[model samples]
Target: MRVLIVDDEPLARARMDALLKECADVDVVGSVGDGEAALAAISEKQPDLLLLDINMPGLDGKALAARLAHRTRPQVVFCTAYEAHAVHAFELGAADYLLKPVRVERLRDALRRVRQRLESQPREPVGWLHARVRGEPIRIALDDVICLVAEEKYVVAHRAGDQLLLDDSLRQLEETYPEHLIRLHRNCLVPANRLVGLKTLADGRVLARLAGTDFSPEVSRRNLPTLRKLLRVG
Candidate 1:
């Protein structure tokens, strides 16, 4: 994967470039001192990924990312020194972030995620699985989902009065659900719009209540914030 490093600090850029070289599949195609130069390089080189610093002299990284959000832009990984900007980086669809003075292992992990994104198939549209129910893919409406149950490797889509088995994993469904689904566990995905309430059980377990259903799905600790954010409670 071709990568472009965008940072004003000479030393930081150099360090990142050196670390990136350790990955056989990653090629440091260009290094620019500012966002303007980064933009120019993007237009010229069209690198596959960008290791960007949030602050710069000319155009800031956030502004640049906003402009490129809709374009055939390179996947972004914010290499900022500030922890405060982490949320902003996520909001911008950044593949990942590396705090300044990056660790080699972390950078390697970021690159691994970038590779996964590049290799994964484009998400099948919402409810596309309904058509494939009987060698004929069923078309389920997004609103029909009441809850999702994960068992082994498959997710079962439970609607208001019926259920359909989907051949997608929870991770893939997370990407597909986006604004519509809330993650209740590492293995389960729930419809965000269908969530009625969240409660902590006597056993010290968190569960999500789905609208129009008695099902209360378990919420893993790691996915709590994601669910809270989707429920507008975070």
Candidate 2:
């Protein structure tokens, strides 16, 4: 399991890192002092687990976990000095809560529970999307995907400055990757992480702007409300 440690205290981060090394099947991907850095690491490193501290100067662990509620990827395990936030921590879908100073055995138990939970869930598809470019087989990393748009009988996966025609249907993609893709329209799906904002045109058409691409796929009226709520925008 890949883990990211988030804590304001340097000693706490060091202790967690030291203890995690003793745990089998665990890898410390990155450790940061604040939630903002943790969020950036999440996007860049994509750690499987987060060992978080609840009380930090800015963007506390609870707030950061709430920000990440849209999708499930890096599971959270709260490691705090206070027990007062235990209920709230579990409400945030934390895999486990460990009171600090976290003991080696308690840390192991928390990881065991996280491992079991992860094992029970459906695994994400292998990072690559098999598709054709120039009638030749090419593999596109799912991380590079900006969005997926249905073009008549096929779905086109958009990257930063490129696209690929895929054999998979939107429904198949949705079912298989419910965490990565958000349905913006009956015919369009945008990567949850890449979605930037929605814009309404003078002609009463709504378009979604993604992070790395200029291809603004039209958002169907039927799905606009749900999409707005998901994006936390009007």
Candidate 3:
């Protein structure tokens, strides 16, 4: 698995790199000294995993994670010197954590969990639910989601195979699928995993291409960086 280490201290980064080298399955692709560099590296390298520190200069780890949440959100294993951020870390759905001066055994355990989760999770299904739309029960699969367009009163669910009109608004959908989907515009949401490519139009508009579909969703300028990060493209 490709991995990136993000830490402010050089010693800590070297230590983590050494430990990661011990695991034959793990390839340490990049290491950065701050959150900004980490974001840049993540956008370029698209690592499968990230060993992040919670505190740093400029953008803190938590803030960086939040910003990158919509884009190439890698499985995160927080490595910090302090324990106070444990609750916050878990809330952000971090896979694991290791205190400073990380032990080899602990690092191994964390890697094990990362592998297990990646292998066990069903990426194809993308987590679906059977919900009543327009008083008719319909199965909404996440993988089929192309784009979500919002009207004044309700949001429209556009899927590759079918489209459904939903009573909930775009904001509600954003909250419901925080980890799985991301907002490209005020009225549209796209599956993060389905985002394959992005392009800037001559009109200065950004568009996102969905995997397995020709549909391109319009992206607002404010959210462009986040979208790019989520897609693991710089």
> Where is model 2 more than 4 Å wrong at Cα?
70-72, 125-131, 137-190, 194-234
Give the candidate order by descending TM-score.
Answer: 2, 3, 1
Model 3 C-alpha lDDT per residue in residues 1-234, reported as the tens digit of each score: 889999999998998999888886998889998876775566456677899998898667887666545433477889998999999887777889889889999999999988887776523454664446668877776655667788777677776566787756777777777888788888888776556567789988889876556678788988898977764532
Question: Which pairs in model 2 have colliding backbones?
Answer: none
> lDDT of each structure?
0.74, 0.82, 0.76
Question: Model 3, residue 43: what's the lDDT?
Answer: 45
Quick one: best TM-score, which candidate?
2
Residue pairs clashing in model 3 are 71-229, 71-230, 72-229, 72-230
1-234 in candidate 1: lDDT tens per residue?
889999999999999999988877888889999875775576456577999999897568887676455433478999998999999888988889889789999999999988887667342324444424656567676555666778775678886667777767767777875756677776677665455457898999998866556778888999887766644432
Model 1: ten consecutive residues of lowest lDDT: 122-131
- Quickly count the clashes in candidate 3: 4
Instruction: Give me the overall lDDT of model 2.
Output: 0.82
List, residue by residue over 1-234, the lDDT tens digit for candidate 2: 999999999999999999999999998999999876786577567788899999998668887877665445688999998999999888889999999989999999999998887777754633677789788888777766778888898899876566799978999988888867789888888767666567999999999866545678888889888777866631
Error of 3 at 93 (Å): 0.4
